[model samples]
Target: MSPTIFYGQTGKFTFRMLATVLGGQSICILLGALVARAIAATDQGSGSSTAYLVVGVGLGALCIVAAGLMRRPWGVTLGWVVQALTLLSALVVPMMFVVGLFFLALWVTCLVKGAKVDAEMARREAAAGGSEAGADDDGTADRVDG
Candidate 1:
């Protein structure tokens, strides 16, 4: 099995890792908005305040949507867009520069490491004589003959 083929399998580690990052980011965006409001940068009852909240909500929603889409190939592309938006949020909230960097690092790490692991899994599966089962973490392959 190729890495791409293996990655498409349900309940893979890469999917879990990337999904976690995006899910966590949704919460962070909301908190960041609250922080901006608390700092008085978003004037009370003003359009800027509402806009900030709206943007936060939108980004949070987008994160969830992206997470759901991760089973598809383009889902990863959507995640990249999320990262870009998070970094751009620094324009409104300076703290986002730090938050964005943290998440971005996680995203990249997960992609790189997860791909390697998946490719390893694919290699192992191939070596397992075309067994229906994938390799386990303990360097063993489960036999699942139909």
Candidate 2:
């Protein structure tokens, strides 16, 4: 059986970019749980601390897992989903609207810019080595050994 390759080796600018944003989001989600609990203290209608922690940890886990899944094709899709959920989090924490928007913009910018950088790096590598990496069906790069 052929071994599955990992695309991360060929291009990691986007990976690092997304990981930073997602890691920060995960931490924020966890912290938001405390905020939610505090907010609920003053407002009975805001929900319970247990529920907040559960939801917060769940969302935070999603972010962390999404970061780990960056080598897969669907990882980017999952990242987008995380972004949407983060934005939707404003429903629970009003301040999250601004935070979510900021992270969303950062995510988009990072993705776009990171891809360009990776491509440029790949071009440079190919020009220097006179060989190009071929992508596998699973979205990983097949490094050609000269």
**Could you say which candidate leads in lDDT?**
1
Instruction: Give each model's whole-structure lDDT.
Output: 0.80, 0.77
Worst-scoring 10-residue span by lDDT in model 2: 1-10
Q: Candidate 1 vs. truth: CA RMSD?
A: 6.8
Which residue runs does candidate 1 get wrong by more than 4 Å?
Answer: 1-11, 40-46, 130-146
Predicted candidate 1 versus true structure: per-residue lDDT over 8-124, tens digit per residue: 433377877888999999999889877765655546555576667778788889999998888887788888899999999998889899999999999888777777886788788
Clashing pairs in 2: none
What stretches of model 2 exceed 4 Å from their correct place? 1-10, 45-47, 131-146
In TM-score terms, which candidate is top? 2
Cα deviation at 99, candidate 2, in Å, is 1.1
